[model samples]
Target: MSAVLSPGMGAIEQAALRSDRFRLEREGDWKRLDAIVTRIEKGRAKGLPDEDLLALPGLYRAVASSLSIARETSLDAATLAYLEALVQRAWFQVYGPRSSLGEWLAGFIGGGWSAAVRAIWIDLLVALAVMVAGTVVGWLLVAHDVEWYQALVPGGLGETRVPGASAAVLRETLFGHTEEQGMSVFAAYLFSHNAQIAILAFALGFAFGLPSLMLLVQNTATLGALLWLFADKGLLIDLCGWLSVHGTTELFAILLAGAAGLHIGRGIAFPGDRPVLESAALAGRHAATVMAGVVLMLVIAGLLEGFARQLIDQTAGRFIVGGFMLAFWLAYFFAYRGRRQTAGGHFA
Candidate 1:
C-alpha cells in the first residue's frame, strides 16, 4: 500500500469495525428504529413550521433507547456520533417554520374570495336593474291576472281576492306574523338559517354560485313587484311602514348573501395570476370570513323579522327599529375599518 493509505488505515479500520458491530447490535431492535426513521421522514415531508418540535419527543425516546442498546453492546464512540447526526437532522426538519399544506389552502381560499368581489360588482349592478324591471313586470302581471279572474269568476271569490285592502291593514298583519315568536327564538333561528345561507353561498361555488345568484335576483324582483303593486294601489306609505319593521333588515341579509355568492363566482371565473385552482382555494378563505359577517347581519335581520316587527305595530316604531339595525351594521363594518387603520398607523 502507498504511504498515504497506510497512515489512514488504522482510523478507517476502526470505523469499519464499529459500523459492523453497531449493525449487529441494531438487528434485535431494527423494527423500532425503522419506525422512528419513518416518522421523522414523514414529519419532514409535511413541511409544517412546528413539525420538528412536535416530533422531538418521539425522536428523543428512540435515540435514548438506541443509545441504551449501544451501551449494552459496548458500541464504539464513533458509531454513537453517527447515530446522533441522523437524529439531529430529523430534529432540524421537525422544528422548522415552513408553511404546511393547510396554510397554502387557506391562502388560496382567501385570495379567491377577494377576486370574486371585484368581478361581481358589475353583475350586482345588472342584477339591481333586473330587479327593478322584474318588479314592474310582476306587479303588472299579477294585477292583470287579478282583473281577468274577477271578470270570469264573479262574486264571493272576489271578496277573497280583495283588490283594495288598506296599507295599514297589511302593516298590521305583517307585525302580527312577526310577534308569533320570542326574541331568543327569533335570534337563534336567524343565526342558524343565516349560517346555512352563508355556507351554501360559499359551497355553491362548486356550481360557481350561479344558482345562489339566480335565487337572489328572483327574490329581489319579487319584493319589488309587491312594493310596486301596493304603491299603485295608493297604499305605498302604509306598505312602506309595514315593511320597515322587518323588510329592511331581512332584505339586507339577502343582499349580503348575494354579494357573497358573487364573490365566490368571481373567484372561479377569474383566478388572476395564480393557477385557477389555487386562486379559487385562496378566495374560499376570504369568502368564509365575509360569510361570517353575513351571518351576524342575518341574525339581526331575524330579530327585526320576528320579535321587534311583530311587537311594534306602529310605522314610526318600525322605522326606529330598522334604523338602529342599519346603524349597527354600518358601525361594525365601516367603523371597524377606521380602528384597523389607526392600529396599523400606530404600529407603523
Candidate 2:
C-alpha cells in the first residue's frame, strides 16, 4: 500500500482524496437508495413505509447529481461503474414502467387527470385566447355584413343561417320538432360530432399546433355567426340560455383538447433539457389523460343539450345547470389537485 499522503499534495493525490471523501459522505445514502430500489424491483413498493417512499425521489436525484460529477471528473473506473449502475437502478424505480392497469386507472380517476389538467393551465389559457379571438372576429364580420356568414360557416352546418330565415323559423330550429328518433338521436349526433372535432384537434397538434389553431378558429367562427343570427331575431338572451345548457362544457372540452395538441407542438419546439423525442413522449402521457377526461365532458354536454333543452326550456334553469357543472369542473381541476399524492404513493 502507498504511504498516507499529506495535505496539499500532488494533483493525483488530491483527486484520490476527493473521491474517497465523496464516497464516505454519500455511501450511506447510496446504500439506502439501493435497498429501496431493490424492494421496488421486487414489486414491493406497496410495502414501503410512507416516509421511505417519500424519501426515494430526493435520494434518486442526489444520486443522479453524484453520477454527473463522477463522469465529469473522470473518476476511477470502479467508482464510475458503481455510480452508473446505482443511478440506473434508482431511475428504474423512480420512473419506470407502471405497476398495473387497475392501479393506473384508480389513480387517474382519483386525481391524476385533474392534476394533469392543472399542469397545463397555461396552455389552456392560450387556447381560450385563440378561441375567443376567433369568436370575436367571426361575430364582428358577420354582424357587419350578413353575407360573410356563409363565407365563414360551412354550407351543411349553416342550415340555421340561410339568407332569409325569419325569427320564427330559427326559433323552431332551436326548440324544434325532430325527425324519427327525437332527442336521443340528436344527443348521439352531437356527441359524435363533438368527439370528432375534439379528437381531430388533439391529433393535429403534432403538426406544430397550427392545424389545431385553425380548426378552433373555424369552429368558433361558425359559433359567432350563429350567435349573430340568434341576436338579430331578438332572441339573443334565449339563444344564450339554450346554448349555455351545454355549450359551456362542450366548448371547454374542445379547449382542453386543443391544449393537449399545443402541448405536443411545444414539446417539439422547445424540448428544454430533454431530448425532443423524450419531451414529446412525456407530453403525450399528460395530454392523453386530459383527452380522456374531455370525452367524459362531451358525454355530459350531449346529455344536457338533448334533455335539458327539451325539458327545462327556461333560461335560468339552463344557466343553473351549466354553471353548476362548470363549477364542478373548475373545482375538480384546480381546487383538489394540490392535496393529492401522485402515482407511486410519493415514490416519485
Candidate 3:
C-alpha cells in the first residue's frame, strides 16, 4: 500500500472506511453492507449519538435474518425487495419513537376545546340572530294572511303532529326486523343517514361553523313550530310522546356534530401559539373522535326510532326513554368530561 496525501482525510472518516472494509470482508456481502454502513456513518456525522449507532447492529441483524427467511421461503423478487425496504423504515421508526396515542389525544382535545369554545360563542350569537330574523319572517308570513298560514300549518293556531301516520308506517317497515335477519335491508337507510350527517357536519366546518349553527337552528325551529302546532290543535301531549322516544338521542347527536363543526371553525379562526395548519390538524382529530361518538349515538337513536319507539306507544314509556337519554348525555358531558383535566390544570 502507498500513502497518498489528501487534505479531505479525517480521523473519523478513516475509521469508518476501515470499519466498512472489515465488515465487508467478514460478511462477504460488500455491496449491501457497504451501502447500509455508509448511511449509518453519514447519520453519525450529522450528530446521531453512539446509542443510535449501537442500536443499529441489532437492526442490521434483524434485517439480515428477515432477508434470509425470505430467500429460504422463495418469496417473489418484488416482495422480497419490498420487505427489505420495510425493514429499513421500521428500524428508523422503532429507534426514533414519536408521539403516543395519549399524547395525541391530549393535544387534540386541549387545542380543540380552546378553539371550539371561542367559535361556539360566535355560533350562539349567530343562532340568536337567525332566530330573531326567522321570527320576524315567520310573523310576517302569519300576518300577511291567517288563512294561508292555516293551510301551511294544518293544526291551525297551535296544533302539530308527531310520527304522522305515514312516518309511523315507514318506521315500522324499517325497524321491524328479526334478530336472525340481522339489520335487514332498511338498516342501510339508518347507516347511510348517520354517515351523511357526519360528513355534512365535517364538511361544513370549512364554513366556519356558520352553516352548522344554521342547520341546528333550522331543525330546532321546525321542531318548535311542530310543537306549537300540536299545542294549538290539542295534540301537544301526543306529539311529545311520539317525539320523545328517539328525539332525545337523535337531536343530541346532531347538536354534537354541530359542535364539532364549530370546533374546526374556531381552530381556523384562532390558532393561538400554533400555526393555523397545525391547529386545524389538531382540531380535525378531536372532531373525528367526537363525530365517531355521534355516529354511535345516531345508531342507537335509529334503533329506538325504528323499533322501541314504535313498539311502545304509551306516553309514559316514551317519556321514560327520552328522560333516560337526556340524563345520560348530561352526565357524560357536564359531569364526567368536566372532571377531567389537561397537563396544566383541570379541564373546562
Candidate 4:
C-alpha cells in the first residue's frame, strides 16, 4: 500500500530534503577544516602539507559564510549547529592569538622582561639612590650607638649575629658546616623568605610608595648593620665573599622589586595630565612585568645561596660566580638587543 501526505506534511518533507542537500554540498569543506583545526590544536600542524596550511584561511572564511547563510535561511538545526562549531574552530585556527607556553616563555625571556625593566630606568635610578642612602643610614645609626644594632637586625639573627658576638663565632656563621641533604630545605626557606620581602616591597607601592621606600630602607639597614658587625671583626672581606655568591642575584631581585614599587608610587603621586588611577594602572602593568622577571631572579638566587655558596669554599670563587651573574644581568637588561626597540627604546 502507498501512503499519501497532506499539504502541510509535504511542505515539512520538502524543507528536510533542502536541509540535507545544503549539508551535503558544504560538508566536505567543513570536514576538511575540522581535520586541519584538530591537527593544529594537537600540535601536529607541522606535519600538514603546505597546500592544506595555505588553504586554512580560505576554508575558515567559507565555513563562516555557510554559518551566516544557515542562520538567515532557517536551515535544519543539525546543519546549523555543525556549521557553527566548524566555523568557530576554523576561526581560531585562522585568526586566534593563542600561543604555546614555550613560545610565551621564549618571548618573555628574549625581550619582554628586559624591555619592561628598561622602561622604568628612572625608577631604577631613584630606587638605587634610596637603597644606597638606606645602607649608609643603617651603618651610621649603628656606628653612633651599638644599641642600634639590636633595632636594625631582626631578632632571629640577633641571637648569634649581634654587635659583639666574638670574631670566631661570627666567622663561623659565614663559613658554617653544611649538609648536602639539608641544602634543598634551606634553599626553599631562603626563597620563601626573600620572596616575601620582594613581594611586600612591591605590594606596598599602592600606598603612594612611602611605605615601600621605608621597607626598602629598613631591609637594607639590616644588611648595613650586619656589614658593620663583620667589618668591625676584621672579616669584612670574608663576609663580602660569602654574600657575593648569592647577593648579586638576590640583591638585584630585591632592587627590581623595590623599583617596581617605586614606579607605582610615583605614578600615583605624580599622575601628570592623566588621572591618578589611570597613571597608576599604566605603571602597574609595567611594574608587574618587571616583578614577574624578579621572581625568576629570586629562584636563581635561592639556588646559588643553597648550593653554590655552600659548595664553593673559596672567597675568590664566590666573587667570581657572583660577578659573572651580575655582569650577565647588566648586559641582558641594558645592552642586549635581541629585538627591535619601540619608539620609547623598549624592545618590541
| Top of the candidates by lDDT | 4
Model 2 deviation from native, Cα RMSD in Å? 8.6
RMSD of each: 11.6, 8.6, 11.6, 8.5
Candidate 4 global TM-score: 0.70
Rank by lDDT (best first): 4, 2, 3, 1
Q: After the best TM-score superposition of candidate 2, give how far the Cα of residue 287 lies from its true spot, in angstroms.
A: 0.8
Off by over 4 Å in 1: 1-137, 143-172, 175-202, 338-348
Model 1, position 77, has a per-residue lDDT of: 79
Model 1 residue-pair collision total? 19
- TM-score of every model versus the real structure: 0.53, 0.70, 0.53, 0.70
**Which residue pairs clash in candidate 3?**
158-229, 158-232, 158-233, 159-229, 159-230, 159-232, 159-233, 160-229, 160-230
The all-Cα superposition gives candidate 1 an RMSD in Å to the true structure of 11.6
Off by over 4 Å in 2: 1-38, 41-103, 156-160, 176-189, 338-348
lDDT of 4 by residue, 217-287 (tens): 88888889888989999999998898898888998998899999999999999999999989999999899
Clashes of 2: 0
lDDT of 1 by residue, 167-194 (tens): 6654444445543656544335544554
lDDT string, candidate 3, 166-268, tens digits:
4454333323333323333333454455456555765798676777666654545445554554455455676677677777787667666777787788888
* lDDT digits (tens) for residues 1-348 of candidate 2: 534557769988878877887788789888989899899889787788989889999999998998898899877788889989989988877888555767666677778888889878878998999899989888999989999988877655536556478998877766643342436554566667767879999999998878888888888887888788888888788778778878889998999999999888888888899999999999888898899999888888887777776776577887788788788888888887533335554412
In candidate 2, how many Å is residue 216 off?
Answer: 0.9
